[model samples]
Target: MSATRSAPVFAINHMVTPALRPQAFFQLARSLGLQDVEIRNDLAGNAIVDGTPAADIRAQAAETGVKIATINALQRFNEWTPEREKEAIELADYARDAGAAALVLVPVNDGTGRQDGERQNNLRKALTALLPVLNERGLKGFVEPLGFEICSLRSKREAVEAIEAIGGQDTFRIVHDTFHHHLAGEPELFPQWTGLVHISGVTDVAVSIGDMRDSHRVLVNAQDRLGNIAQIRKLLAEGYTGLFSFEPFAEEVHQLENPAAALSQSIVLIKSQLQA
Candidate 1:
């Protein structure tokens, strides 16, 4: 957008259209002129959960020429246990076999395991256990801290500290989601440690910040109240060269008759703002 800087690269997330199949999702990414995408395992009847083979997903990526950025996510990852370990192994193996470069690790968000010293220890424990699994598969773990009040992990600083304490500086990185970043009211930016950026905007004037949820997350536009453009500018200025994947969770966006056109407009608006 600047005379000296190129525009940030944008990627599509499967959440944009959970109705589409994996192959169609890849096709959608290619149609958007994006080669990178974040796929989800939570979608009903989808991969990883529905038993879709990793080889099939890899073939889809190759055919559509879309790079699988990550599998979103291994839920409650910080509450490490034997069950979590098993799930982690399966997901990490799926990520590796699917040609994805990273796995998203979402911490417990159910208002439990968040005590002062307890949360840090739990975080370190999970990281310590996951380091080897990720290392074995040669995959990066993108630790995403949710911004909800009930979330066990709400601070990127804490996640970073845990990562450093466990000596996982290289094995793990953070996901700087614009929505979560704003919700958490975090002012710090770790551009160097960021591996992915999820972008979504909440424009409803009636909803208070505390009341905002994933259902309110919509595509970024001029009416966005999330300061998405400002966040992007800062990240870019600070040398964050990761993909900005659209991750709108609003049902309105998912129901759009032409999401590709809507996403294209959003991209244009973001680019124009950066240029300005």
Candidate 2:
């Protein structure tokens, strides 16, 4: 591997510290030596969902000098509806004002939108609807296909095709989530088309891959069964130099008394694996 392709750049998502205030999350990112971070709107009672002013988020991020990579996502993004359009517009505006680099677009994972002939139409409609909104705000739309069987969009291949079909390669990019990718059993990596990579690991020896859920996610380590290191190595070796945002969803990670130390240890382990 080339020296330039050695270790990936690291980032953290608000999910890692779902309980922290937005300002504190920014401070945490800076203190961890991570230059980039992602925020979320789903955290109950949090700033975004609670309607904290976007100006506040922007100011806090500026003070900490940590770039807000994205808002965790616009859930069920592909199921276009008047409500979803309104939601997208609201998020796009926030993303613009908050200085967020992109707006993550997560597909419908409710197990209801995958019916015959509905999936493709929903995806195309969502992309077409979102292209202009993101373009207007000068924000990239990071479309993430969940790996779950019920997820309407399960493959990056399909996401990329939809993006291309809509001539949205410039306005939209795929989020190659390591955990989701493994879950979906994807055989190919769209390294060049990927704009972000969410990293998490599953270390439970007894948990089967099919039974894995976000709650099972935790920081990467020697016991990780998700092949995070290997997947990262594939992306880096293919010249995908983008943010690797930590997104462990397990309660253990969220409840950690010193998440910073635990995060640093995971980062060290991942980096060492890449260099090796």
Candidate 3:
């Protein structure tokens, strides 16, 4: 249980404050003494989704000394279609322009896409189509499989297999999301194939995994029932030398008036646990 000097790198996602503007978000990362950060394309009023200029985002990163670890996603990425292709092209363009290192790829979670053995076929097709988009942008695709029962892609093993099937191993990687992993109840950890790890904790003792939702997500602490510290320990032990980005989606977290202070506290808590 001893902490190593090589504790996983910490990063924060904009979901920590979905309402925070670009520069303000970057400054919050800095205030927490974090150099790595992830931006989102899903926040309704925010720049990336709201059509804010990429140069403006790049400038904000430069000014704040915070590196853009990733853009939080191209949603439902596994269910490829003409519209999905267009969305991928546009989002990849933005990621490239913004100097973000990678794009998070979230598969469809609506409980319908992966039925009757069509799941693997859909996954391979998506990866095949996405390979060139990411390669052309010199960006990495982080395929994140959700753990929900209805999610099209639930297993990291399945994601890795599909990535290999499409020869996307060189340009794509898996996002080892802690919350999803707990829900998936998988026993293995694939550190080598992981590009990023999204960390969040759920403390609602009354909720079952089947009923858990993003609104239940919150920063990891002693109250965490999801085993964040142990899961992180397993990843690091498995040779995962990537960014551990905080990605709490609770509305209460997003509504925090002093997000910097809150994040700083969470950072200290995780660090202390890692060292224990």
- Reference-based lDDT, each prediction: 0.94, 0.91, 0.89
* TM-score to native of every candidate shown: 0.97, 0.97, 0.96
Candidate 2 segments exceeding 4 Å error: 1-4
Sort by TM-score, best first: 1, 2, 3
Best by lDDT: 1
lDDT of 1 at 119: 93
Question: Please, what are the lDDT tens digits per residue for candidate 3 over residues 102-208?
Answer: 99999998887777579999999989999999999999999998889988899999999888887888999999889999999988888888899999999999999
lDDT of 2 by residue, 94-166 (tens): 9999999899999888888897578988899999999999999999999998888989999899899999999
Candidate 1 lDDT, 15-124, residue by residue in tens:
99998999998998889899999999899877657899999999989998999999999999999999999999999999999999999999898899989999999999
TM-score of structure candidate 2: 0.97
Candidate 1, run of 10 with poorest lDDT? 1-10
Error of 1 at 268 (Å): 0.3
